[model samples]
Target: MELQQLRYVVAVAETSNFTRAAERCQVVQSALSHQIASLERELGARLFERTSRRVWLTPAGEAFLPAARECLEAADRARAEVAAASGEVRGRLAVGAIPTVAAVDLPVVLKEFRRRHPRVHITLTSAGSDDLTEQVRKGGVDVAFLGLPTRVEPRAVQSRRLARGELVAVVSPDHHLTDAEMDLRSLQGEPFVDFRAGHAGRAQSDEAFAAAGVRRDVAFEVSSADFMADLVRQGLGVGMLPAAYAPRFHDLRIIRLRDAPERVEYLVWGAHPSPAATAFLELVDHGTGQARDRPDPDGPAG
Candidate 1:
């Protein structure tokens, strides 16, 4: 039977009189009687025994009353839950970010977002850019902080650049090259600690080196920026890292290369985002100077 049949049965069971039940249900008495007859026929049981002066429930009606009430309650709850999910701003948000962006930028933004929308539960994951992109594409994440060169399927995802951060040289303060800004050419033949292959930053570094007609003396290949920084601190080699990531360590000198191309971080999502995700993108775009009509490609100047 349809949900309306269940509802009508419950209303009739509550009132025990077809006239009163029809009035309560806002339907004609004949229509209510016809629907109730259809419901009982569908169930193969008479729900009510009717005489000229009295209306009374049969054993079948008594048994069906509680089940009908339960079905109506469940339908109501389902509607309420769906409405809450669509209209309320409270829910879980699964967000993914590249390791560097998660370490350097997400903490502050997430703090503010939590303060503003306290009811939203957030789950954050940090992985490589390629991995994060795959997570977003697979519907595993609601939103992601992904680096450029992501292979986003057309019409399935959209991206907004959030900030532009450049690769800078990181070296111990005592290193010979630590005192001055170095060009990509200057890094030629210098001992370097590089990221593992398939990393966006590593690819960018390789491109910069190729453009500058230089080769990196890669002393070690590591996956994490913090580890690379530690290697540089030990004077193992100089390394190239995002500018925002360089400030996390002490006793390390950060030098901007004169000719290094900038790397940009983007907020990526399925074509449409939830309200909470959209709000987050707005805050990031504003805070990072990416919201302006003519946003500077390098972000706001320091």
Candidate 2:
């Protein structure tokens, strides 16, 4: 029988009167009675005994009442769960970030986002910019924070520049060059704690040095910005780092180099982002620059 028929049976069972049951159900008594009669006919069992003075339940009606009530309750719960899933803004979001950006920027943004949207689950992964870009392109992450000079062109993925940060040279406080801003050429023979070759920061560092006609003596290669900073602190060599991240270390001396290039960090995604991803992007937009640049899909960059 139909769900409404079971509802009518339950209403009548609860009220013990056809007229009151119909009123509770917002239907006429005759209509409610007809539906109950139809249900009884389908089941081939009489659900109610009628007397001149009152109406009473049959043995079958007693047995069916609990099951009918359970069915209605289950249906209600199913509807509620579906609505919660779709409308309450709950889901998992996977985000990737380059080591430097993750170290300096992501913590504040993620903390505020969690405060505002407590139901959304988040997973974070830190990698070099090149690796993070591929993760976004291949759908391993819903969104990513990356620096410029993307390994794969922007056309294959969507990206927006979030912040323009100046790159600076980080050195131990006791180093000779730590006291003053130096020219890019002055770093030619200085020992350097370099980022691994494939990192975007390393690429930018290499480009700036080559353009300025400076050749660096590599002292060590490390994959993490934190590790590079620690190495610099131990007097291994001067390392290049973003200004925002440089302030985090108290022992390191941060100095700006003349004609040093600025780096742009981007929020990259594959195609359109999901709802939760879009919300997180909005938070990023408010924190940094607006998302104005839409990469041209079939252009030379792809």
Candidate 3:
């Protein structure tokens, strides 16, 4: 009913413990519980099923959660819109990226955004490209940076290609097979350390190798770029990474591939973005000169 009641419900649902939820909302346990009880009486259904050990959302609560969240988001967006009308960008900006984000200097970009819009709060998260894409589409993330094979582009979101580069082999200095450049077949016998199966990072290599009819052994499948580099540097297996991203590990050696897979980095956002998101996007456009005039169409790669 009331916005404050919805906020309390959301807080309780997220924490799953009345006391912890009260602490998070900066309210006493008794007050929070009383408010939830009052709401339950008004709705004529229980929102949560509570036990001595844990609390969980009942069916009614599950149905109410989404609408409650949408209401909260709408309220926030209204406030943001009013602020923007006054030429002020004051809202939360959630940015997501892959672990090996190299197309843009994120630190410098975020620093500049903060300097210009001091009122906007920025949060950065790193995940697989597909996950970031979904988060953006679902409104969990305001903006995202993702990399996929050149043959494919992000689908179902507003996106622009920032840069394209080829994948290169990463090896240890002590490895015996030394070459300036080689094809995928040459590394067929070498064990590999790669991103997890189905991940955008791994998909490029997988599709390329499958197209070339090359079968390789993947010894380590990891989520962290640094860990993958560590494994390759120890000669556990060879790794494939974007040419731009591989240079960050100075201790590792980079070998160009004659038939390397190409990757395209993109900036993606939802159809309706917040004012803070709009401000950050304009700054990005000004810096890169890749304005929003040309937006990639929404669909999966053929």
**What are the per-model C-alpha RMSD values against the true structure?**
15.3, 16.8, 3.7
> Model-by-model lDDT, in order?
0.73, 0.76, 0.87
| Candidate 3: stretches off by over 4 Å | 288-302
The residue-by-residue lDDT of candidate 1 on 1-302, one tens digit each, is 88888878888777878899899999999998999899888899999998876788899999998888767755754554564577655555678877666223577778877887676778998777777777777656778876543222223467666556567898988888854686988777789998777677577787778778897788899887888988999889988877766677777998888986566667788655556666676677667322223232644221
Instruction: Look at candidate 1 and tell me the lDDT of residue 229.
Output: 82
Model 3's alpha-carbon lDDT is 0.87
lDDT of 3 by residue, 1-302 (tens): 78888999999999999999999999999999999999999999999999999999999999999999999989988999999999899978999989877767778889889998898889999999899999999999999989898777788999877767788999998987789798999998899999999899899999999989999999899999899999998999999988878888998889999989877788899999899999988887776433222133442221
Model 3 root mean square deviation, Cα atoms: 3.7
Candidate 3 residue 80 Cα shift, in angstroms, is: 0.8
Better candidate by lDDT, 1 or 2: 2
Q: TM-score: which candidate is best?
A: 3
Candidate 1, clashing residue pairs?
none
For residue 213, model 1's alpha carbon misses the true position, in angstroms, by: 1.1
Off by over 4 Å in 1: 1-87, 102-104, 149-156, 286-295, 298-302
Per-residue lDDT of 129 in model 3:
89
